[model samples]
Target chain A: MKRDLFIIMFISSILIFPMTVEEIFDKVDENMVYKNMKFTARMNILEYNENRELSMDIFMRDENNILIEILASSSGHTNRFMKKNDQMWLYIPNAGKAIRIKGHMLKEGFMGSDFSYEDMSENRKTNDLYNMELLSKDTLYIIKLTAKSSDAPYKMKMVYIKKDIFIPIREEIYSSSERLLKELIINEYKKIGEKYIPINILMYDKLKQNSRTEIVYEDIKMNAGIDDKYFQKSYFER
Target chain B: MKKIFLFLIIIPYIIFALRFSGEYNYNYYYYQSLNAYGENRVILNMNADKGIASFHLQGLGQFYIGGPKYIIPYPDNIPNYVIDNLPSYYQLSNSMKINTAYLSIYYLGFNLKFGKFPMKWGISQTYAPADIFSSTSPMDYSYIEEGILGFLGMYSFGDNTISFIYQDHTDYEQTKQGLLFENINNYFTASLFSAHFFNTRRIFNGFVFRTNTVEYLLSGFNIITDYWGPGIWIEIDYFADVEYWIQDSIADYSHYFLIAGVDYTFNDLLYTSLEYIYYSEGKTDGFTYNDILRRYLNDNFLISKHYLIPIIGINQGETISGEFAAMINANDLSSMIMTSLIYQPREYLSMDLNSSFVIGNLGKDFYGLPPIYTFQLKFYY
Candidate 1:
């Protein structure tokens, strides 16, 4: 009788630990957020039997500022994008001046890729912008997140998180009209120090025909003491 | 052609050692004038970068086919004044000139550059009062400013920068020195610039505020705001002690120019912008026709008291884009409309087709100008 009781208690503790939706989001944010990081990434865009590649260097500070520089491209090169707070600026080497990109332009695909500018610029804590609810719990924890504000790029997202590491493995993004717009699949994960990072990502645009983009991250350095000057506009002139 | 081939041969060696990229452009222009002419131009641009050092070079070749008698006039001697106003392309009836050649070095937080390069300033796209380094030509849509021969040094801090330029005009025995300070932020950017000219015969001898023979003290302020949905920009330029020759007499005056513009994008598919400009020193209804001509001869031409410009752009996809722009002269009711289409089949190759038309009554602004059509193919690697 005591063995059966112990078994029932063990099963109950495993199933009914009483984890809140907010706690799950907080755990995910804690595992994914970084103070400052620098990385080089390559994007491969595949569409209609054609493959295009672009390489870029990225620097991020806190959660609100980011600097992206295109290192090499088959097309024109030396393009830069800087995001500070809510404002974003693009500098084209030919124009030799930085132009402000308005909010509506954030939804457009970046450099003709499947990733939108908003997707590239989003560095905020997920809990700050999304309301989360537990959907199911199997080998992975499934959660549905809805944007807290209308200004968000996607209205809803269904995220599948690894139950052990609290890292997202897959996500489905929905448009404002509740239509599936894009699917993001995390292909590979690397554990650098204490953090688990998704190093390879595949994005598929459901609304488009035979269009997909793959991002591979390399030379990633976290907490590398990047200078604050890198986020300033004066550094963009080069 | 031999020199160009040799230069292309050296590019491969440089690419193996460092970062090297170049572009070749071929364009054809058709002008609808009384003497209707066609011009074909081929330009090559090469750039190399390694560590703290970089180099840029541009070469252009032009061939004129069936133009008016006056199109390529051969003179005994090319006047200094003509050379001063010559396009940076360095086109002469007999010889070709190197358009741009520059080398730059960066160390610490300072950048030092030498040789000839194109420098552009001011917030307005079309007419910028603060663009004292280059002149805008109404006949071409290329927007290629004449390169300046000079040495430039710049130092940048967090959000602030300071720059100094020493420009030399050896042929005219003159030099210009300028200092500029700028600060930039997420919402706004501002700058203050001052330039001094030496060896200008018309101005007071030593350290006079001038660019070339013209004496002027200039200051500009620009503000950009996005507190609202769309973005609004305001720019103002103040010119103090501007000297102009009126019927062989030099006169001094002060004036200010103001520009206000707003831009917006809808659904990430279309972009639109509207801008208005007001020039305090422009010829208005109060000035007679001869007075306008005198202003034109004084190096201030085609500037109206008021101007309105509207621009629209459509991005069909990654391969196609189109733009339409109209510049309206409020005083004379004249307007210039331009339509352009760009097709990019590959990442490094593109083709562009452009057409421009001018409409107004005779003797009015933009009316005497002829329509133009252009087709260009660009390849970059």
Candidate 2:
């Protein structure tokens, strides 16, 4: 009994210094936010012994703009998804039309993948819209975040952040009623310039059986000096 | 022809950024107590994108096999009086067409396009009153994208755009000019448009017998938004100065079309929506002369006053999805329910099956034709 008590006290002494939620999230922002980023990725979706693959080149500028150009598909037709200023537009090359999507539609799976448009959208500055609390401190900083804004993608999120690197290694997303919706794990990261970024990720929908999506980034470039013209509709048509 | 041939040969050498794509689609339609048909369609497209300019050329080839042919020979036995009116086998034909050929230029703040291209604009899936250019045939919806010859120009400023279009109908008197303004934002997409046709024709007994040289006006507004939890859309269109030209007498009047709807999605996997539509050109009790004439000229979906549509769609996995819909004519309680399924085993191959049930009297004004069941196989390269 005395040995057990001593072990507990020893662990407590090591935890005398603790990190604040604000400080941790500020570090997170540093690792996540960027001026311009370009990445080429391949997504593999597996369900019921069947697999589907999609190849895309994603470009992002600032917090509100992202363009996903689907490079390869079965029909060899080019399609695009662009998010600018809280609005999403889907461009079909065959139709020559850009259809504006809605909020709930953003929550649907993108191209039959496990990733939602909400998940593909650039979500930055976690400290701004979420009430953050550090849940525990050990090998990792366990944190809980409840959304403070109505337009937040998820009602609540639990983050498992790696130490020193300030990058989240895993996350559990929950709905408003506290139901677990999806679980995401970052499998690998690459040290690019001064920051560490996730390069391989896996997401599973808790509501489905034997459903999984794996996203592997083939190439990633940070602060690549991407032009604003590439984010416009005319440029997308070209 | 010589110039086009020269351009096609030389341009391929000059432009290294050219892409070629084609599709072959075969659809078989069968119905009871009606003629069965099979159609084979092939489309080939060549596209070039260089700097601020782009070009697209599409060629289509279609073959109608066993035209108006049926597997079941009429009836086993019929009275001589009924046998005299039996249907005859129709001859099959084949044709090739240049579906679309357009050149688009984007420079500074202006977007310019000239040639023959399909005009696609609408909000709702089934009934979009603002889509006055070309409409889709829901029953036989294969290779049905129609393009008109036109020149279009548009200028954009921030969140708003203004466009002008001029469509040619082989002569100056049959030309059409239009202008449109739109503002797209995070919450709502709204547009106001107007088109004026220099001349239109009159249809009688399923044929456009003569042309009327009177100006006609078509105008509309469309607004779509995501309101709180569900998506809501509303569209309104007006037709003015329509000339009937019956018995060498001119009958002029106006008509209106309206549509409003809302949709909700469940867990991002299931989609559901309900819609209500109103057509002013139709009668509440029955179809009018204006309604029948509009149906002959334009391939309008509904001919009666009120309609309600409920649709549900589900995507279970990466490769499979299905949609079921019911369009009901509120005036007579007649309805059509349809379901379509698509399966893609590979990126280059797909098979589709669609079946529908029509529940109404055989003499209804619209959607009274025998329902067509379709099985199609498509290949792409």
Clashing pairs in 2: A74-B347
Poorest stretch of ten by lDDT in candidate 1 chain B: B201-210
lDDT of 2 by residue, A57-155 (tens): 888887778889887643445678988776788886556678776645677677766788878875568887799989886889899999997667788
Q: In every candidate, how many clashes are there?
A: 0, 1
TM-score of chain A of 2: 0.89
Best by TM-score: 1
Model 2: lDDT equals 0.73
Where does candidate 1 chain A have its weakest 10-residue lDDT segment? A229-238
TM-score of each: 0.80, 0.79
CAPRI quality level assigned to candidate 1 from its DockQ score:
acceptable
Give the Å shift of residue B321 in candidate 2.
2.7
Q: DockQ (C-alpha) of model 1? A: 0.33
Residue by residue across B1-381, what tens digits does model 1's lDDT show? 334434533654465343445566666666664344344555555555567766665656655555422232112233445434433232324224556656666776777766666666677766676766665644445444445677778888877888887776755435666788877665566677776542232221222322445556667777777657677888888776644533343555667889999988776668889999898967544433333333333336445788898989887654688989988888887788899999987556899999988786554555545577878888776
